[model samples]
Target: MWTDVTLKQILLITDGCSNVGTDPVYVAQTAREQGVTVSVIGILDDGALGEQGQREAENIAQAGGGMCRIVRTIDLSHTMQMVTQRTMQLTLQQVVNKELRQIMGEDSDALPPDVRTKVARMVESGTEEVDLQVALVVDVSASMTSKMPSVREAIRDLEFGLLARGGTHRLVVVTYPGPSGEDAQVLRFEGTSVADAVGALRAAGNTPTGPALFLAVRALRDLGESPATSSVRANPEDREEGRMRHYVV
Candidate 1:
């Protein structure tokens, strides 16, 4: 039920700061380099997240080329939907702009008003028609136990809304701090249905968001979702210091 032109993403739903493992920001950047966008939603119903937690969420999204937000249990459903849709639109725009640059040497914004308007319409339509493959990296740490109900509801809501789009969607579920002492565990590796996985979710172990993200990327790769990594001339804007990926293959 999927298509060839699919957008791959990792949507991380967490409640607090990572207490162990690798740095999430670095992992997020690596994911972006590998053709996956990583978005984060910090749950605030339990208590306010610390500054470090807030910063990490923001940094991860920026590094991974996705979106980030902090929301309460009641607002999670809306936030999740917003983040996923907004990220998909943004990614599609970047792709469209990249193509425009190759053809006209200018981005959409630099085009004549009429031309820009047409390009915008195409991007909008593409956003609604393009397929999606999302790996939901959920936080199963003990602290998140009380929020599982809301989490489950949000997942269902997200799936319902996305499936209503013209394009097909494939969803995978992965939870961090595996019950058996691992960094992350894959409850649902295939797609769309997460009920079984949600029932299997257990609240235990310390948070390990970084390692969990790494595993999520690996899982997506295992499923052959990420685009093939090949060498290409770096875009001019991407030539800035710390942004270059010359001859990447």
Candidate 2:
């Protein structure tokens, strides 16, 4: 069984549109139903993706309840970092709104916009010290071959960006169509950089993104059960004093 965690996301980076079995949007919707967010980054370089591809990217994100953005290869790293931070911010906002509804009455939706913003800011500041686990699911289909270099640089930049935020995080890299066709391979680097693994990916085979996402979710669930992550509580309680503070960001 999969363990419930504070945040579980599948960041899909692809260049071409899906041409496989199940629709990617449906897969993304299933992920959301299972408490996982799926964000898509469509890489557009030299006019690789057309109108249909862009629409598919947007539709997938909408179905998954996450953000989608299209960017050139040169901007991949910056966009990747932005997407991660944006997802965290949006999640924080949702947590704050839920807490507000619980603290205030159900009819307290009458609060002014500025007041709500202030409260959200307070909540974000309070939860800045929390840790995060991100699953990066990259599409290594044949079409994305030319964008591999940019993808590698992006992952490296994302790591530095996360570090600058002063939060502890574990980033697991999952690539689709591993040596064998349509297989999702989970790669981990000990005493080495994940960017290397990403850069080494060879683009081949079909884009079985639906199955890849299923694999990513499973990986995240397994990560949640690890001994290191097991000790961290999303909503911690003061056992001695019988007080509790619910924090989810």
Candidate 3:
């Protein structure tokens, strides 16, 4: 079994449009090319977000090769977990589809009903067992002020839910437009709790979504190379071996 495969995801939690830096969609696409899934969760304001805001959110997720959802602050907690899991399944399915094409010269969608059903089941099962490394590219833009309290609580809830899962996991929280003039800052969550880092969050500054995403993606790439990671890509042989074992390609 390819148990060493650590599912990587960058979950962008934003409530409004990106008003600064490069276009987030392009940056997300770059992350996807490096095998990282970037999902987005847009927090609704007064139960509404502008059309442009909605389009940008959807575009970013699409470019990242992941999923996107717009939800109320109250639903953020549940939605975060849902998006995370669903995107993981999506990532696995993509991997499997490529394998099917390379090995069988057929795509999953073109497979017979019975074979497709089995593939779907296998992807679902992978979601439950694969280890996870998720980074939250949070927007502390001025508009997110009132939503901060609920956002903090939702993050804590997401952590608890992740801990309950069968596979091991780690969390990274990065906020955009840092207080002291940084584009993005990676906050360490000491002792499995996000108290200190998230507590210092100030909802001020432009929504530099693209720069923040680039920061988080680079951080994750470096992290995956660390010895602490049980990632299959730790070595060349394991990386090739991973493609074979992970999807039975």
Choose the strongest candidate by lDDT.
3
Per-residue lDDT, model 2, residue 211, is 74
Task: Give the per-residue lDDT digits (tens) of candidate 3, residues 131-158.
Answer: 8889899888778888888888888888
Candidate 3 least-lDDT 10 residues: 229-238
Off by over 4 Å in 3: 47-49, 227-249
- Per-candidate TM-scores read 0.84, 0.82, 0.86
Best to worst by TM-score, what's the order? 3, 1, 2
All candidates in order of lDDT, best leading: 3, 1, 2
List of clashing residue pairs for candidate 3: none
How good is model 2 by TM-score? 0.82
Q: Which digits, one per residue and each the tens of the lDDT, describe model 2 over residues 1-249?
A: 002225667788877777776777898898889877889999888644688888988998999888999998888888898898788777656665666677674321467786655555444543344456778888888878878888888998887765654335667888877767656789767555789888778889877777777788788788777743222333432341121132221
lDDT of 1 at 9: 95
Q: What tens digits encode model 1's per-residue C-alpha lDDT throughout 153-217?
A: 88888878776776666677789888888888877533444754586578888899999999889
Off-target runs (Cα >4 Å) in candidate 2 are 1-5, 105-110, 228-249
lDDT agreement of model 3 with the native: 0.81
Question: Candidate 1's C-alpha lDDT?
Answer: 0.79
